[model samples]
Target chain A: MKNVFRFLYELLIGKPEPPMETPLYRSEIFPDVGGVSLLLITLVLVLVYYYVLNHVMRTARFSHWYHWLGMLLINAGIAFGYAIYYCRLHEVTPDSYVYWFAFANAFYSALFFFLFSLLLKWRSYNAARTPF
Target chain B: MAKLFIFGIGGTGARVLRSFGMLMAAGVDIKADTVIPIIVDPDTQNADLNRTVEMLKSYKRLQGVAGHDSGFFKTDISKLADMDTRGEGRVKDAFTFDFGGINQSFKEFIHFNEMDPDTQALVQLLYTQDNLNSPLTIGFKGSPNVGSVVLNKLINSPELRFFADNFRKGDRIFIISSIFGGTGAAGFPLLIKNLRNPNSGLQNAGEISSAIIGAITVKPYFGLQTENESVIDSNAFITKTRDALAYYKNNLHGVNGLYYIADNPDTPYENRPGGASQRNDAHLVEVLAALSIIDFMDYQDADFGEETLFHEYGLRQDAPSITFEQLYEETLHRIGQQMVKFQLFAKYYKDMIREDAGKNYYKALNLDAAFANDSFHKELRHFLENKQWGYFAWLEELARNKRSFAPFNLSTQDLNLLVQGKPVSRSFFNKGITQDGFVVRLNKEERNLTSEANPNRKFLKMFNHVTEDFYTSKMPGI
Candidate 1:
């Protein structure tokens, strides 16, 4: 065994021969670290969702399910952008941000448009029920 | 016997005159002569202008000024069709008619100010326009050949002749024009012909021994290349303007002393010519040209010699031996010319000092702001900050005065955008501003070259607006 080790060491090229026996495993695997990071992110996202839900319920600002759904969609879009571009990549640039920063309008307009439409519809339905 | 006649040709000209008139009243104390210049302009009907006119009319000295020499030198449009262009008739549209009430109001103003028309010998037209009534909408709509129309009107007025009769021996007359466009170009010849003519353009036609006319004609600033081909490439228009100026110079060459302003072609146009450099230069030239005619407080021209105050309404001299354009390369660093130079400097080197590691805010502040940074936008802002007369002041005034009372759904993001730096947006030109954040924030430059910064005609349009406001309203504190 000692002779075999010495012969293998002789075959080494760049570095001086190792003084100790080599271990097979790396200190940490990238996939494990990545999964743990992803789990923490999901936990935070879930908390944010629940907090927003609780706040919405307390305020009663959105009485309808559609409004809640719309808000969720919009928030989701923002979260997606944050997670992919900002949180994960950690990017900050005036040039990258200044122009073409108009994506937020889509989500906002969609939610607002539906809310306003629902408000109008609700008024009509209430009036019909009361026989004004 | 003295007359102060100020004619505002286009927008910039009129506004400058308003300031000039205000300055004259507050600064130069004219006794036994006209206190207020007779303001001639087409925008007399504007509500703001009427208010200003009423205020001017209320001046007690204004009455005495007119009472001493009170005849309206109304312009005569050879044809009735000329009056209908801007949606009015010549009887109502003409300067004489539009300002007639103010002329009548002089009875009260002059008495209050205690002044008289000593000699109605000189007249100044602040109405600067291209050869026509150039409406600067994107499509170049509503432009009529107002230059010829106005020229004909002035030449045919009987009051002009009556005024010329007032000029006595040793009296002097000065006509100032910047050799840029229509009104000045056309008016120069008309003024020279009548002034020098033995027949009867001046008050006392023979009394005028000498005349001094100055023009601050800005030659083409080379930055014009980036401008829209439709506007800048109109060679026919340019040639007409150029040739008319040339003719005026040749005609007036021998009759008077001359000075001029040349354009600094090196000015940067992040967008194009006529914006940061061109329009600013135009206003500076026009205003400085107006100031050039002001007799200095201590400046007694020995050559004027035993001058009697006389008024000349109708008589104009022929074109002289020198044109303002010919003198452009030499003496007279007219304000407009200097402004062009500064714009050029800022355009080229504004960014250099900003990048220097050792430069501090104090150090940066000491440098000429116009050229301290490479960014034209920053340079423009800097230029305006230093010189109150640049485009920044005018834009602020415009945004302030515009009657934008409509309720808008605005957010911090939106407000930041309106106040924030964006190019001159064609989309937003007169529409105030669009409401979408995406529309504003999405674009890389925020505005397309022609659509945004108005480095070309948009800047000039701002100057023109001031001119219009000048004739129409009282000065708003900026």
Candidate 2:
């Protein structure tokens, strides 16, 4: 019962650990974290990002340019959280190169914004061409 | 171009012609290239006649500014004189013929006092003293005997000759009159008899005499507020109608199509003979009478037999007050949708368009200046609020009356009222449609063309396109 409880707690809140046996865990991207757990967390974050992006697009009309920015900020916030989780799980101190490298992974969130804004722009352009 | 020369015979005739103009404005199919309305009434001061002439002129002005071949005001009605001129202009061209030298007492018209004693004695035997002495400036006042003499000169007039001279091969004639009244009853048969005469002394007498003809004889549908002494009486309407119908059964000729319309006298209008007080509410009978013209045009010439094709308006169910459901499916399909759509368009301009005047749609259509203090806007307002025969008043009266065509769920409270069967429940992304929904739908349906720069034309064309789409969307069968 304790083992089950511990596993669930670790899966949800996550835990610090020594390097795992898998090469993915020992890879340059996230050297001290468990590869499976990191993948699971990233998958969940991508889903959450997609869900929030959909909600904004559905509710907010693309009349103003700022709506696209607002959507980007939401996705960037989620991507930044993924970087912070990697830093915590890998035990990378703030001053190290790996710490900055993992933090730089936050820029990946730009892809989400780029793809999101592109879709939004395309929809708005088509809408402008097409009469109501 | 085939023209439909409509002879609106008297006060009832003038009123029905006014309803026909209103129908034409709403984009009803009149099936004529030009509609030449010749109002035949000896009463120069008759209110209904003057009002109808004024309305026909307004319709002309609106159609003039509206682009060529627009669905709105598709039927072009020119004055009898202007039909000869290409550079036609002005509203005061006058649709009514000048009664001229006939506005005096019937006694003066016949030179009763100067006649020999033997002739005077014969005139006394033929006409009552009051009938002879009564002034004709207002009308014959239910005295068809007096009306017969005054209206007979119409067939020989310069206007009739001009009309006959221009009459083409495929051109047709339709007459409107009331069976119970003086002028209409007397003038209808006289006009027909003269047209059928072998020698009308016009340029195309043979063709004009044998022309395909349609007529609507309106029976008494309302009572007078108070009976006047030398005026019409509602009590005698049935007896007059019976006598007239009996006469028509034997003598009515030269007409290929005939329509009869009457309503139970449930709502009586305020009685007035001349000037502004003579406007009557739009009735179901008159609207159906107007529809008979449409049906007449729809029939091929071969369908008309030697005897006149007689038609009477009927409802799906007999009710004192009718809703959209009580109308025949064919009636609903033909006119119900167009009426509702135009009502919505009119209401949008009347009630809901002020805030929206600054929108892209208004700006694109160039209506911003017109809606802002322009003469065109004033003309539009006059078309809507012209005390007696305006669009808004017509719809309101039709709605309140018995045998209503309650197609729109109109109200003082709800701006969001749906057209009869439109869904009240919201669709996927749309909050249920309000009157604003019509404007939104209009935006979708309006053509993207910018060629016609006249604001009035743009407004008319856009609405004509939009209402068609709006109705078709609402009623799938439409």
Candidate 3:
């Protein structure tokens, strides 16, 4: 799972920015941010969209393609914010590497959101055919 | 399953058949497997007959796509000519009985000028100048005397022979006519007489003579404007009804079930004797009369006794306007839920379908393309909302007529308040019957109807199931 996250994030923005923080970035930051935002949060948001708002709430109001896009963008924003907060919590060197990693996380979160949507949307009552 | 052949005679017959078509389109449970409506009118230009014919044609088209088991247009209504599967008969391929265009005067029709002097003298004494000069094209002109002579030739007509040829042993017959009008008053007894006559040399003479025949003789329900030049006089409606009743008491025979329905005239209609301009607003009497057909079909073979069964309709209460509450349990059980469900289906199609284009149910069926291009969708729209003779127009006319039958609150957009006196219950947690709620039900129903291959059938089945669910859950009291 950790290697999968590393490959996905690094594909968008190459390896960690500053040379001094490469070990910390590879060991903790890459896996932590990618696992939490790209996999966990994106999956939760997609479930919330397909199941919570549509099925549980019994509404088709938010089942449009644009609505799905809005959920994806929200997951991306959360991924960006969580990366910055996690970097600060670790007291990492205040450099552009943290911001670059955040950007990479945000981009990968969108891809994860789309992938999760395709897998989960079929069982939804109202959003089954949505965004098709 | 037995087939029913309904013979709708004259203008009142046409109007009643229109209401009957609406009921069938609303998915009312009619017992007959097939209903063949044969409209008998010499006035081919009569607006009421033309409208009923058009509505029946549209209904047949919808029934072709909707199928017979469920949904709108579930009842099977076929033209009499279509029953000629052998393709050997000369019956016209139309709903109305072909009169072959009666374009001459009544005098010319009877060959009065060629008659001998003594026979002419007897004819002159029996008929006045206006009666003789009355054009056959405009119909009997409230003169049953003229109607009787012209309609007596009906037994020999090719249509009657064709009907006899196609009729089977278990098939039944129903006749709808007005007791106070020209063509119906004369045609009803003549038709019954011909059908009951064992010697009538039609193909199925024995079967037709012994058929379980039912007839609804609509009495005077609406008056007409007094036109000095017009041959019809509204003041004479009661007098004519009294005379017809007296004649029917002795002459009318062989009917297993005879239904009598009438209403007091509250508003006067324009008295155009005949033709396209002589359209009358639909009355509650016509709707009730249509119900008699359904009621007649409800009976079994053993239900009828040796005597001719007689029936009369009465409301639960005498009110100026009617709602579902005023209807008896039997009437409600027959049509109430179906009518409400159909109204909801129609209102949704008219008011909410365009906005619901984003709904999953809408997309799953690809309704956008179907609505724009498919003939089934177009016919459905025309059936529900056509301004002149659509289902909604029928409802509007019924409401506008005196002793109005206004069961649904058609003016309101709120689905909860649709049924008059029966508002859908709501709670703080559960908002009753919102547009969103309708879409949710529709979306859920779409998944259940996936096995239906045809898109049109799927669309109708989805709405039919969803509306039934709403009726069951939301409007329990109804």
The numbered model that scores best in TM-score is 3
Per-candidate interface DockQ score:
0.01, 0.04, 0.85
Write down the RMSD of all candidates, one decimal each.
25.2, 9.2, 1.1
Cα lDDT for residue A35, model 3? 84
- TM-scores of the candidates in the order shown: 0.32, 0.76, 0.98
Residue B395 of model 1 has an lDDT of 29
When only chain A is evaluated, what TM-score does every model earn? 0.26, 0.42, 0.94
Candidate 1 or 3, higher TM-score? 3
Write model 3 residue lDDT over B11-121, tens digit each, in one string: 999999999999999999889999999999999999999999999999999999989865778989998888888886589988899999999999999999999999999
Chain A, model 3: TM: 0.94
lDDT of each: 0.31, 0.68, 0.91
How displaced is residue A79 in candidate 2, in Å? 16
Candidate 1, residue B458: the lDDT equals 30
Error of 1 at B264 (Å): 4.9
Candidate 1: Cα lDDT at B309: 30
Which one wins by lDDT: 1 or 2? 2
Clash count for candidate 2 is: 0
Per-residue lDDT tens digits of candidate 2, residues B1-478? 4888888888888878877888888777767888889888877777677777878888888777663466667678788777766644322357887676465799998899999999999999999888898888878887788888987778767777778878888899999999988889999999899888869777788888778999999998887776565266678889999999999989987789999988888866676654446666667777777787787887877887788888888788887766676778877766766676677677777877775543335544556666667766777778877776677777677778765655566674343354654434456665443545555544433435467666567677777776666566545532
Poorly placed runs, candidate 2 (over 4 Å):
A1-132, B86-92, B226-230, B273-276, B373-376, B402-405, B412-432, B435-440, B444-447, B450-455, B476-478
